[model samples]
Structure formats: C-alpha cells, structure tokens
Target: MVDVYWRIGMHGDQSTLRRRAETRGDWAPLAPGHLAPGWGDGHGDGRPYLEHMADVARAAEISGFVGGLMPSFPFTDDPFAAAASLVEETRTFRFMVAFQPGFVHPWGAARLSAALQQLSGGRLVYNVITGGGGPAQRWWGDEVEHDRRYARTAEFLDLLRRSWAPRPQSADGEFYRLADAYLPTDLADQPFPEIYFSGSSPAAIAAAGPFADYYLSWLEPHTALTEKFTAVRAASQALGRTPRFAVRIDIVSRDTEAEAWEVVRDGFSGVDLTALAEGRDGDSVGVARARSFIDGPVRDVRDLEVEPHVWGGFSLLRGGPSFGLVGSHEQVAERLNGLVDAGVDAFILAGVPHLEEAFRVGDFVLPRLTHHSPQGALS
Candidate 1:
C-alpha cells in the first residue's frame, strides 16, 4: 500500500488558492508565507498574513480538500494562532503547523499543541524545522552554528516528549530546562499530534530517533532518495526509533502528460527572478544546496529531474523542498509509486497557482493514487 498527500495552497498571491480551486477541483492549500520569499516586506512585516491563511483554510474546506500547513516564523503569522482560527471553519481538513526548538519553550509548545489538538478534535500536525534561512534566524536572535541548531532541537524534542507523557517530565539540557512538567489535559483516547522533521545534516539525521513521526525530505531523484532513506533508517534504528518518510514537492497536473507540462512551463512566469537571486545569495544551507545542484555536475538547476515525472525548476527560487511532480494523472501516479518503492510513505505535495492545482491534483491525481493503493496518514 502507498500513501500520497497533496498541499495546493502555499503562501502566494492573494487569489492563488481560490482561483486554483475554481478552475480545477477541490484540493488542500498550505497557508502562504513564513518560508515563502517575497512575502514579507522590506520592514520584515508579512503581508497577506492571518487573513490570507484563514481565507485559504475556509476555501479549502468549502471547496473540498484535505488540509493546510501552518508555518511558524517571527516574520509571518503565528502557526498556532492561524490554525486555531481555522478550526471551526474547516470540517475534515486538518492543520499542519511548523515549529522549531529555538523559538519556544518545550513545555509551552506542548501545551499549545495539546490545546490545538483538543480544539480541532485531534486535527493538528506539527512540522519541526531546524531554522534554515540566515535572515529568519536573525529574527529569533538564535545565531547558533548550523549543526548546533539540530543538536539543540534534539534536546527540545526530548523535553517535549516527556512533557506529554503521563508522568511529569524532568530534563536539564544545555539548551533547555524542565522540572516535572506535565499537561493537565488528558488525551488518553486521542493521540498526541504527529511530529515532522526534514534535514540532510548528520546531526539532524541523528536527532530523528528522539522525536519524529514523519521524516521529511526535499525533492530529490529516486536514486538520491534511496541513498538518503537508507541512511535515515540506519540512524533511526541506532536510536531505537521507527520513523515514517515524507517528501515535500510542488506538482503540475493536467488531463494529459502534455497538458501538465504546459502548466509547468507557465508557472515559470510567476518566478520573481530578482528575489530568487537574492534569496539564493543569502548565507544558508538551502541556498548552498540549490547552488550545488545548479553549479555542480548538474550544471543547470533545471536539469534536476532525476527521475521521470519529477521536475526541479521550483528549486531555482527556494530552498529545502524545491521540487515538483509534473505529469498527467496516471503519470503522477506512477512517479508516486516509484517513490513508494523507494520507501517513501507520505507526501506533502503542492503546486503553483495553488487553487487550480489543488483541484487538478485532488480530483485527478488523488483518486488514481487511492486506486493504485491506499494507506493511513502519518501515524
């Protein structure tokens, strides 16, 4: 069996999600901003903030999609606040909120997640980030060396796990301190919200053992994915943990393969070439990884289609997860199957002009995916 997920709305133009929904079919839209470039103004104030996220969440439910990803960052709307507002507006649609160790206290974070879980009736998913962008780090006043952030995150998650346990948790780590902290709420029946993390650093891989329900990855070819997954599994095993796999991807779907490619080509027009270059130039692991793809043996970032039905053009603008699955319904299904064969269990997929892309993917791709095989969501 295989599990395939899609996220259509990501912070972008105001009407991107709605327009996509109207033209295509019902699909999920991840809230825009936080990590999206060109979103925050020169003053570092984010536009299309909570209002845009609420609209996208409302539209996703009304229009018929799964859920949205709520990103956490000082510059954008708070993930918890954004998700809390959408609880009543959406029915089955859930919210995936991003978090990092350095930003909030572990006890406070656990309490926040518990409240959200209860309010949304257990419709909360947490994405753990290790602080990537250099500018974003400056906002939090966290200037730890690259790998150290992951080390601190591991400590953070350890405290978080203990906080959620039946007995109060006590921890005294270099980065965090907790003394018999325990949540008053009882969630005996409903499970705690799932945790997600993505990183290629050795420390990040090593940290997955402590707390990770879903291990996330950027868009990579099948061969690269195979190698990465093998290493991640080994790391998790050494730590006595079993983590599921997921990949973040943009998508281009159409009635036929040719039509899908046409949509992919059209998306290039929306790229902010100047901002893209600036973001790429910033000192961050994401930018360096993107440059390696473009400047190395893969001379052109555009040549990053390591497998059929996968494209890396979006990586040209952003970092971390910068690839898209491009093809017709069936072709998309096959590519997804290839990833499943490589041990990928979950997918956080999206597309440009989000609204229409959501419908195309949800209506066309999801059904094919379900028919091909069906599996449970991230446990």
Candidate 2:
C-alpha cells in the first residue's frame, strides 16, 4: 500500500501563485485580523494561527491524505508544537514532524514522541533532517562539518531506538554519552514513531541504513530518482534492514492541461533563472540537483519543463522541492503512477494554498491512483 501526505504550511501561505508579495502566516499575525483570502466577503473566518493550522489538518484528514507534514525551520513555528496542537482536531491523521537531531536530545525527543503517540493513538511519524551545512548551521551555532553531522544523526537515531526499549540502555558514543537510559514502561510501550529520513548525500543514506523506515528525497527526474532509490534500498538491505522510499513534490493540477499551464504562462519571461539559482543559500546535494535541472535561459514557461509535465519554475517561486507536476489531473496522476512503478511507496505532496489544494487533489486526482483509498480520519 502507498501512503500520501499533504504538506502543512507552517511558514505561512499566499492565496495565489501570481500574487505572492504578502504571505499570511509568517512571523506576524498567522491569519491576519479575521479574514483569510478565500474565507470571503463582509464577515471574517476569525481563526488564529493554531486554528488555521487545525483547519489545514482537518482538510487533509478529510481529503484522503494519510496525514500532513509539518516542516520545521528557524522562522516557522515548532513542528512538534504545531503537530501536538492538532491531536484534538484530527484523529487517525498522522503528523510527520520534521526536526534536526541536534536540536533536541534523543531521550527528550523520545519522551515527546511517546506522549504524542499515546495521545494521538500512534498517529505520528518523523522526518528526521540533518542540517544542510552552511550559514543555516552557523546560525544554529553548529560548527559540525557535513559528514560529521550525518554521523551524529546516525548515532542520534540509534540512541532514539534504544531509548524506546523498556530495559536500561547505555551508550558512550562520539557525540553523546548515555548511562542506563530508558523510557517509562507506558511511554516505551507506545509505538516508536516511524522515521522518514531525508538526505541526498552518501552519509545520509548510510545513516538511514540501520534505522530509517523510509528514505525520503525531493522529487527529481524519474531516472535519477530511480537510481537514488536503488542505492538507498541496497544500502539498507545490506545493513539487514528494509526501508521504503518516498518523494516530496509540489503540484499544480487542474481540470485541463491548458488551465494548468495558464496558471504560470509567463512565469519565466521576466524572472532571471540564473539570479534565482545563485540566490539560493543552502549546501544540499538535492538543492544542487534540482537547480541543475534548469541549465539554460527562459524565453517561455515551457523552457523549464525538464520532463513531461514536470516544471522547474517552482524553485523560482518557492524555497523547497524545486520540481513539481503541472498538468491536468489525468496527466499528473499518470506521472505519479510512473514514479510508483520506479519504486516509490510514499509521497509528501503540496500546493500553493495548502488547505484549498488538499481538497482539489482529493476530488480530482486521488481517485485516479492505482493504489488509493479515501483515508480520512474517523469523525
């Protein structure tokens, strides 16, 4: 069975792709006064930040998505706090909380996740991120190099699993020292959160080999994506483990192909692709691979079409996951099934206005899937 997750916009969202100057949920008022963009007219929806996020989670829960991915960043609300807040609003809707291992100690993370699992009845997953070494690391005051950061993550995950055991666990590793560490019986009994690890580097895969339940990647070309997954699976299997593969991709699905293209007909005409690529500030191999997709200039929007229906203009518009599907529902679904055939068992999908797109994809695209069932949380 394949699982599909919607991305929660913790960093705020705009109403349209065309008009993005004003974001609704960044640092300031999350919902801004009372009116959300589509909430309409003279009256206001009157939702605060957490309330708006609950609505987003509820939308995904009802729209056949298995869960919502709450991404963490310096500028955004804590994914753990955001995910914990929604347990009352949603049932059976898993929360994929993204976090770097260094931020919270493995034992503390275990306690938090176990409490969440107990509350939400095992509706939790993890998107373990090792920081992309750059200024972001500097801001975090982490002087660890690229390879060592991943090594720390591997140690962190190993300890995390051990911390879940009822018996006392001890480890004296390079980055951390634990003496007789163990969770309470009830907390330890709560199912350990399944991990979906992200990294485009060899060290990342090596870390994922022993502990990850899913090896995750941002969407790339089908061929490259297949090759990457092949390597990941081989490494995991060699470690005597079996990890699944997942990809994150944004979408622009519409009733017809023409309507989808019309959403960004002149997207690249005025924008400088080189300047956009150069302006990116992360040191991630995945980022580099995604940026490399747009090698030449841009006279038309079609110039960024790296593959059939896969558009690269998303990097010009957003921060993460540069390539995404931009076609009619049928075309997008076809491409999705193609990716599945190439060995993807899961997906983290997103759109411009998250709440609205949750319903749109559920209504038009999900039914076309080869392995889909309407997976709403029980009311």
Residue 362 error, candidate 1, Å:
0.8
TM-scores for all candidates: the values are: 0.79, 0.92
Each model's lDDT: 0.64, 0.81
Best by lDDT: 2
* C-alpha lDDT (0 to 100) for residue 41 of candidate 2: 51
| CA RMSD of all predictions | 7.0, 4.8
For model 2, the superposed segments whose C-alpha errors exceed 4 Å read 26-47, 266-275, 371-379
User: What is the per-residue lDDT of model 2 for residues 217-302, given as tens digits with 9 covering 90 to 100?
Assistant: 99887778878888898998898888889989899999999998887664444455565556357667777887776767766788
* Candidate 1 CA-lDDT value: 0.64
lDDT of 1 by residue, 41-142 (tens): 443333344454555565555544556666665645567676787788777777888877788899888888887787778988878888774767877888
Best by TM-score: 2
